[model samples]
Target: MPGIHPTTYLFAARALRDFGDGFVAILLPVYLLLLGFSPLQVGIIATASLFGSALLTIAVGFLGARRNLRWLLLASASLMTATGVAMSLADDYWLLLVIAFAGTINPSAGSVSVFVPLEHAALTREVSHAERTRMFARYSLVGALASAGGALSAALPDFTTGIGLERLTSIKLMFVIYALVGIAGGLLYARIPKRGASHETSRTPALGPSRAIVLRLAALFSLDAFAGGFVVQSLLALWLFERFDLSLAQAGVFFFWSGVLSAFSFPVAAWLSRHIGLINTMVFTHIPSSVALMLAAFAPTLPLALALLLVRAALSQMDVPTRSSYVMAVVTEAERAAAASFTSVPRSLAAAASPALAGALFAASYRSWPLVICSALKIVYDVLLLMQFRHLKPPEED
Candidate 1:
């Protein structure tokens, strides 16, 4: 912690943002249902939101490379603020769709906003290469823990009736809280010193020297993201609801534990990366998690399926911070933002297509095909990544 930069504030802000995302990810489909949107409609909105974020992030990655990261973060936070407020007020189907397309409402439990690349760029600059993975681990730990708290907060509706509040109103209030969190995060971004801006003096293309490596990673990451889209938290919760007759409060409890378990894996990932290297750590832990998910698809009872999901949760996210650190370690400081964005934009775009497909599958027979598909694709991605990048070690790994 002593060598850590002043960007600790950014980590806190990320936690806050992720916490908001946690509740919203669970609540969005439920809220849409309350408004008479079908499961298929929910998936459409999720895809639209992801697609819109990908476009916005693409612009930010390109233009932001030449500009100050602090301003980009502030601007993203401001948009986050407006997104919450807008969703809370809009009720028309088209209007809500438009908002979904443009807003920062992450239907998944992970971070993939324009803020991601900018924040990674800044955070990487603040740490030594040796400490980068650990720093990112702590950063992800804070996010996961806060998100657990937020997921638990979804139980608010179960209590809101005691005060005469409508269940839907209680859910809407969560978005209002999201807007407030954005305001607070903006203030944090404002604290970034002017000297902490980009290390670039020369104009750089979005990919620059790292173009080929980044593109390869991006293609693989997109396949992973596409697989991820099939079982995003919202759709997964919806699956539990339909398949097992789960209540909202019960879903909250499940997600809270899922977040906690995923969080526990971050430090473990950092430690493992120290021994086996980042790519190996990512691949070895990931295959088992995917296998757990595949097994979950065939689980006979609610408890059994839930247990498998918990197992998957414990291992699925071990790659997040390691992947981020690996990308940063390989790219030049000037290419950090571009690498982050190029890699993430494809992921967002790839993930954008699957939610609706998942919804359609659920709509048809409540089949467990999505989980099986996700598992298979993820395993393919893991194998390909390991095979391709096994020899490309970060400097710390040497």
Candidate 2:
């Protein structure tokens, strides 16, 4: 740790956190179903977790400008530990719902926790304007690969059960492992050097001259996130189980491959952004992914559907690093932390509102509704984003 760069610690911590998130995104609904909860309940629980994360992220964004970010990250890591512990211990629907709401459970394919903005701000500070996009691409690459590995680990319960552990107990142990990952992440965050008092004093107020741009971007991002919530990994896994009767092990393998594709696309995105600009790369790549998702909704066979989902996976996430870099690029350095939070909070809240609706659609036997709706809304978001931001290039782009 001493020889490593500070950003390396952030990347490592991100990988650890995302590994836990990847499996949890896949296993959460299954675990809840095994505990006798319905799909609607599962959706509601996912919503609660995301909604709570939004609130916590908001608090961090406000306090982070004034406080040491290392401490904030450490605190988030602690909440993650508590979340897994509480979830593993509680079986009652109401109690589990409470844990999901108050804890750091991530029900999506990507992280939407308080840790995101904190890490983004930290990472932004460590690089030059020219290096930022590639740096973020590497960060995304690390998270994606780690998440893929975590997806593969979702099969651990099957291995444990085969060895005579009770099936339920085996599943519970996964949550225990999740708690352990949180503790490990905390250790990594502990190694990041803190900013001095002079740096703290010079920190700009949250959302100053960039307030209008941030608000507009936050609104667009919220729409995309709301659409995305319909197919958050947890709900998507539920769909696979209901539609294709996909086994848990099979889902793990499929998502692992999907994540791998997404992971490798990060650098490609960085390269593409250099040629076409960030706005073009974000919009053009995203539209194809959404189209793939929409087509997947109507696929008659599991193989075709999975193939399409994989295609979507490959292209859908190309915007992640670009978007993060773009936000940091446009805002003043003082506004970066707040910009990250402000943009992310609305996305989190909008995303939080949709899982229950998607679940209800599932409950009503409209199984493909979520996928169809998600694709449609995402396409709309892509078009709107391009139209509004195409002229507003970042400094590096200029």
| The best candidate in terms of TM-score | 2
lDDT of 1 at 80: 94
- Each model's lDDT comes to 0.90, 0.93
Listed per candidate, the RMSD to the true structure in angstroms reads 1.8, 1.1
Clashes of each: 0, 0
Query: Could you tell me the lDDT of residue 351 within candidate 1?
Result: 97
In order of appearance, the predictions have TM-scores of 0.97, 0.98
Tens digits of per-residue lDDT, candidate 1, 197-284, equal 3445445566777889999999999999999999998899888888888998999999999999999999999999999999999999
Candidate number of the best lDDT: 2
Tens digits of per-residue lDDT for model 2, 283-385: 9999999999999999999999999999999999999999999999999877888889999999999999999999999999999999999999999999999
